[model samples]
Target: MQHLEDRFNKRFGYPWVFLNEEEFDESFKTAVKGQTSAPVSFGLIPRDHWFQPEWIDEERATQGRMEMKAANIIYADNVPYRNMCRFNSGFFFKHPLLQPYRYYWRVEPDIQYFCDVTDDPFDYLRDNKKTYGFTISFYEWEKTIPTLWATVKEFMNLHPEYIAAENAMNYLSDNGGETYNLCHFWSNFEIADMDFWRGEAYTKFFEFLDSKGGFYYERWGDAPVHSIAAALFIPKDELHFFRDIGYRHEPFQHCPRGEDWMRGRCSCNSYDTLDYAPQSCISRYEKMFH
Candidate 1:
């Protein structure tokens, strides 16, 4: 919270809304409050929104978990992780406290900020008509989402009308829409228009995916879910990449290059950015424009 405040929110004064499955402790709330003068609010996630639905077949979901765990997939055995992915995918934007807002910047804990955020990305989204913005893009672990692409293909077949006339399909697939290339924008950090999620296309998309029970039966992540929807439902140009924000979340980081590093007073190595890494989808995303 402090790092975000010093690097960005301090200048923009954007209020922060923190949500959790359980109530936040007083000490933690006090600590976050002390981080910035910006208004802060905490909300407890509804029980139904943060837990697996009763309709899910526990036997099948358990078998799925066992298989992934045996294959050594990260978080394969963690039910809480599935709940998180599901909540983030379909319910976060629907939280009562968030309904009044039109735009949001999702921030995770322990993220390192290496540069000063000079502009309000919320304004950027609104002014420029961009629906989603992200700092990192990469391929997901194929082992965790074996059925996801097939399911997505099914959804597209059934709801072709929802797809945009000009979309970012090329960024997601190498051979038309036959297969998913597994590339997705990392969702841990994102600046976006919540209305897009709340809109008809995405709401229906999430409902279709949720009905499949993939959140529990398979480790379908929010990153891919959001990326796939944005890539298919909107114009390709509506998705913006925030190259100026130097940010890191654990094993990967995106440090701005050349003049952007000097402009932002960034500390991370410019050459180390994942923009062109073999596993990154940034080059694929860039290709859509040229």
Candidate 2:
């Protein structure tokens, strides 16, 4: 919290909303509150929102978990992680604590922030008419989402009117929605408009995905869910890449190159940056605008 505050939030003074399945103890709350003067509100996720819906087949979900565990997928056997994924994908924005906020910047613990944010990203989103912004782009593990693209395609067909005419479809599909190329913006570092997620198109899209029970039966992640929604519902110009923000989450780091690196006080080696790596979809993201 202190690292994030010192690097960015301290200057912006944006309020923080923390959500967990269990109640946050006083010590945890105090430690977080001590780092920033901005209002800090911690809320427990609602029971219904954080648990598997009654419609889900528990036996199927259990077998799926076992299969994924044998395959050594990350957090494969963790039920709480699946709940967390589902919550973030379709329910987080509706929480009472986040109701008043139109924009949110997602920050995770232990993540390094190398840049001093000179401008407010919320202001940028508002002024520039952007609905979603991200610092990283990558292809999802295909094994985890083998049926997700088919599900999304089915939804698109059923509700064609929800998709924007000038959307970023090419970024997601190469053969006209027959399959997914797995390109998705990493949602962990997102700064997005809540209104966009709450809108009719995204609401219906989430409903469609939820009905499939993939969050439990398959390890459907929130990153691909949000990325697919943004690409289909939002215009290309409204989707942004925050190249100036130097951030690292474990194996991948997005560091600015050359002059901006020096100006941002970034310590990451540009050569080690994953933005241009083979696994990254960033080059394709750039090509879309050209």
Candidate 3:
């Protein structure tokens, strides 16, 4: 994170805030320059290791469980080395940034932040009623998603009272059950709604996924988890795709194309904005801005 931030600073001056999960505050504090507020070093990464240090034992255990699974896929297997992020996308709702306002921007470690972000992503979320948004979405191997659906099924059965739609299931399960298009919105970079995600249904979904060890064995990542949650839990029209991200994820990438007002990139699907326009929410924002 420090190294990536160092590179980012050469070209960008955006406020860089490091939320601590625990410890490392002194080291984290020393490494960062300019005005910054430190939050819980990114929140507890639920781990399962028994002999682990107790400095923040509970979090580590939880991380071992939830954080490791999703992170294991590309992180340990691919180049970036080391384990996948423990805090992962949990930092978004953790709300160190939104306590005063109502939204937040989330950046992952080691990702490149390019292009001038003149537009406010939070307002974009509000104008569209979008609970979640992402710059990229792509396919993941079928093998890795072994237990995620099973767990979700369990959650559905247990919470029979919760309302879910047939289309939402289509958004999640696809036409068949053998594979997940895995078109999860890349969470490495995001700006999103707080209330939409912190609600009972979304929280229950995470807990349900956690209980079934989806975050562990199947490597169910925040991308897929958030995608499924947003697709199944949140209304369809309210979910959005930010065409301006020009996002790149090594193995896969999405660049902005003819999204009119967006003039942004969207690799989630070749056809995503084909029906809509990049200006999508931007066009409406103009009316509101009017």
lDDT of each: 0.94, 0.90, 0.50
Q: Write the per-residue lDDT of candidate 1 for residues 1-290, one digit (tens) a residue.
A: 88888889888888899999999999999998999898999999999999999999999999999999999999999999999999999999999899889999899988999999898888898999999999999999998888999999999999999999889999999999899999999999989999999999999999999999999999999999999999999999899999999999988999998888998999899998888999899999999999
**Tens digits of per-residue lDDT for model 2 on 1-290?**
77678888778888889999899999999888888899999998899999989999999999999999899999888999889889999999999999999999988877888877777888999999999999999999887777899999999999999888889988998887778999999888999999999999999999999999999998999999999999999888899999988988887889888877878888777777788999999998898899
Using TM-score, rank the candidates from best to worst: 1, 2, 3
* Model 3 lDDT tens row, 103-151: 6567655555333345666667887676767666555444556666666
Using all chains and alpha carbons, the TM-scores for the candidates as numbered come to 0.99, 0.98, 0.64
Tell me the spans in candidate 2 whose CA falls farther than 4 Å from its real position: none
lDDT for model 3, please. 0.50
Q: Each candidate: RMSD to true structure?
A: 0.7, 1.0, 8.5
Off by over 4 Å in 3: 1-16, 22-31, 35-86, 89-92, 95-98, 164-167, 176-179, 258-290
